[model samples]
Target: MPTIHSGPVCRLFVLLARDAPLGVVFRQGPRQLTQLFLWHTNTDTFEPGDRFVGNLSPERGDLSPDGKLLIYVAANYTMGHHNKGLPPRWTALSKPPYLTPLALWPNDEPYYLGGLFAARGSIEINLAPYALEDWREHKPSFPAGAPPEGLVFEYENLPWTPSNQLFTRLMRSGWSQVPTRQQSETVDIAFVKAHPTKPLSLVLGMGSGNSHTYTVHHEAGNAKTKLVGAVWADWDQRGRLVYSLDGKLFTAELDFPGKLQPSEIADFTTTARRRPPTPESASQW
Candidate 1:
């Protein structure tokens, strides 16, 4: 077990192995802009990596299964009030019409990436066929003479194979409202992490307003299992579940055949309480 440090970590993932490499989205200095870092547990230090000047936090990115590829949403920095020392202004990272994939390798260079939008926090890549889900808008449905009743948006889970064929849709969401009502009963699923070996099982973080929960659901089946009530949830390659709630980290053993039992592995609640409000925290509306 690694010692929990006292600082702002937007997101983190550790490979399941002896001396596993740790991937983290760490908040930098007083500005609190997030950047990716590779942590070496043996030396207890972080390796220098790429930096995103904008409001790019850990919640907007994820690491590939092998921890070699990084996919993230690139948000532009917005200038704060002149009275207060702030950052520069820029536009959103995602463009209109379609979602693009922004990828980075070990050399800290950009590569031609493809998928859906990088803004979604819940994105996962699987082995064998190699597929990922992209959330974007689809065609609008109109009732014959009706003027476009509502626009349909879907998280099209696309798969790529060896054949020279177009990407196939693996999973699709039901038609949701245009603007998405705040009080809507629809539970938005995000922060998706697929099982290391099981292609059919997926662990997802579901959020509805202030309440959140983590659940395990089958991709081709309907058996949904609630794992824990948490704001964020992730699984390591070894089938162990790690999650954070109220700023504390907990680990659960899920190799068994039944219900999950999580234990408090590390506590950063005190560190979180002592920190000042970040720009991301203040911008919540």
Candidate 2:
């Protein structure tokens, strides 16, 4: 484990982008710094490489399996403990904490979340998706203070129902005076995708449309397989998949017409992986 108390080190979480070969990493910090690393899966070795995100406080991040697009969630400051009269949850919103996300290519010029705030030593969270060149932001169906936490998605075990309803099981406190409550919420996002096998059948709704379900039919013979529910990491290429019930990462191979061949692979026993760090990168701070 890396030292957390040493001067002010942060935790860097790495995830693959929606469409790239290289991985993206986000590190937590009081100030931003650039640290890039390459992981040799075979040898379990980490090597230093180029500086990815310039010294930015990588608060949270999620990787798409295909390793293309890296979604990073960064904030100006963490929500600290204050306001004894109010519940802990109220601190999450006590101040309008600005969160700025930087979407970048590993070996290229990063699209910095620029503006006056960025110039003033403060990070900016532009909720405006239109400003993002290559990304499109979808409106969330659930209400504020709903079951899901975090800036975008900060919860686990989010399930989609048969009726196309999205459900989230979250443990929340400060919402009420009765300590944190284990809660759930459901909502519907109108979205659809063609079944991998049954071209005519539509797989409607998954992960606020970030995920979906489909069917696959073997062309050589007569066998129909239904993809119960699958989350997309990197389109049809090398992507990460999970069983809806067990939530395990399975290696996926997609055939031309949406047919999928998955192996019960356990690359890691955890849902998230801590990316290796680059030793030679400069500090963005």
Candidate 3:
């Protein structure tokens, strides 16, 4: 068995822009929490930037392909130790317990990002929307009464392209409890990394305890077999994917409509011995 390090083990979450050399990393200390840092490919060091004082995990947000926009889930409540206020009566019968408000942050800005509302749940950005305008105008909601037509309730599980053109969802295969109906469950997709250049291809990370990666082709209506087991993953440039498994790093090629394979790039278990911890290492892919 691998001996767990007892010292402060810093956890890092990196988000790299598809078209730009810039990236942002959220570092959580085993003993303390600090601000996020900026990473540039041209520089070997990471510089401190904005401080995130929220309790929400950093994995909840992602950078756009162009590296200009950031879409992330922001909490409706305030941060810190305080009693959670009473829930509205409508929450019991109709409304969701928490509202999912997505904030779109720009790289150029130091503080503000556009705030947009969506259904409360795990959400991700669909890199290829049918039309940019459709994505811009999309307002998702779940009411007690009749919901709007063509609304995507599973936007979190599947990637959205313009016109809902290419997407995937989890469906059940067993019989349903209801008479003459089959029961189905949505595949709890934990993370989605769309191809930066390909509109119809992307990778889906699923599973709760044991992670699995799958290559999806929206237009073909089929996906390849599990490519590998990964706790989390992110896209690099056009055809590369970086993922973490068993506390080690690996890279794979995105051969959509073809076989996908992964190769080990770095092992955190041993790398600690070679170099001291630094801000750049916290954001290293």
Candidate 4:
């Protein structure tokens, strides 16, 4: 068994850009250092980006459909903590693979942070409309040919929290919540999403204090295949299972059920922390 406090475990969480062949990968490791990478899904390549000394829950992050803009929570809450006159946490809109915000909103609380792109110009912050934005720093840059009028999305005032934030994304990705008998205090919630075309489903168990888990289950009452070393997993647009495992990204070929034919995509295990130039896209407007 691994020691609970052995040390900081390096891991990766990825947010695939909507309707684009790109991804924003959050590499968390070395305690206090969370780095970014722009991944090209088509080529299985990565471009290293900037790093920050804070926290980024990737589940609370989103990328624009154009794969040009990113919305995420940059939080570090400590009792009575202060950072050079900065808030403990804030929601930021930035260019992919960078922490420099094109726009910023001070989160009233941790749970109130994070956002998603609803359409070409519409954005939802905290599952709420763009009006909920605090407007601390408001300057959103769009790529060439993007509509400017619909930047603000119309969203319902739904209850938003760190937990439900994740659930919202899961539901959007075709996952349905499954009621679980909570026998322990740590057990929180779980969701399952079946393959769009396959007879298999992916089960996700995210607990209150326990570790998050993912497994592949056969809907034919056959087997529940636990993806070894899987920290996060989901079916990609190609019906392949893409997951970040042991500090690297991989895509599995589901040719044979109950067996994982894992193929490495990118090896992020050795990515060193460094300052990267602002991507050219963020430099405009």
Q: Of the pair 2 and 3, which is ahead by lDDT?
A: 3
* Residue-level lDDT for 246 in candidate 4: 74
Off by over 4 Å in 2: 1-19, 22-71, 74-125, 128-204, 207-224, 229-234, 238-247, 252-261, 270-285
lDDT of 1 by residue, 175-200 (tens): 11222232224555433446667643
Q: Which stretches of candidate 3 lie over 4 Å from their true place?
A: 1-11, 29-35, 41-54, 59-186, 189-202, 205-229, 246-249, 253-285
Pick by TM-score: 1 or 2, better one: 1
Put the candidates in TM-score order, highest first: 4, 1, 3, 2
Candidates in descending lDDT order = 4, 3, 1, 2
Candidate 1 regions off by >4 Å? 1-21, 25-54, 62-185, 188-202, 205-212, 217-228, 255-258, 270-285
Candidate 4 ranges with C-alpha deviation above 4 Å:
1-9, 76-86, 127-147, 153-159, 181-188, 255-257, 273-276
**What tens digits encode model 2's per-residue C-alpha lDDT throughout 17-107?**
2233444333234345444343322333334433322234222222333332233422222244223221111001101011111222121
Please give the RMSD to the true structure for each candidate, in Å.
15.8, 16.7, 14.4, 4.8
TM-score of every candidate: 0.39, 0.31, 0.37, 0.80
CA lDDT, every model vs. true structure: 0.35, 0.29, 0.38, 0.71
- Per-candidate clashes, comma-separated: 2, 22, 3, 0
lDDT of 3: 0.38
Write model 3 residue lDDT over 49-114, tens digit each, in one string: 433334333343444444433444332234332245311111111111112222221111112111
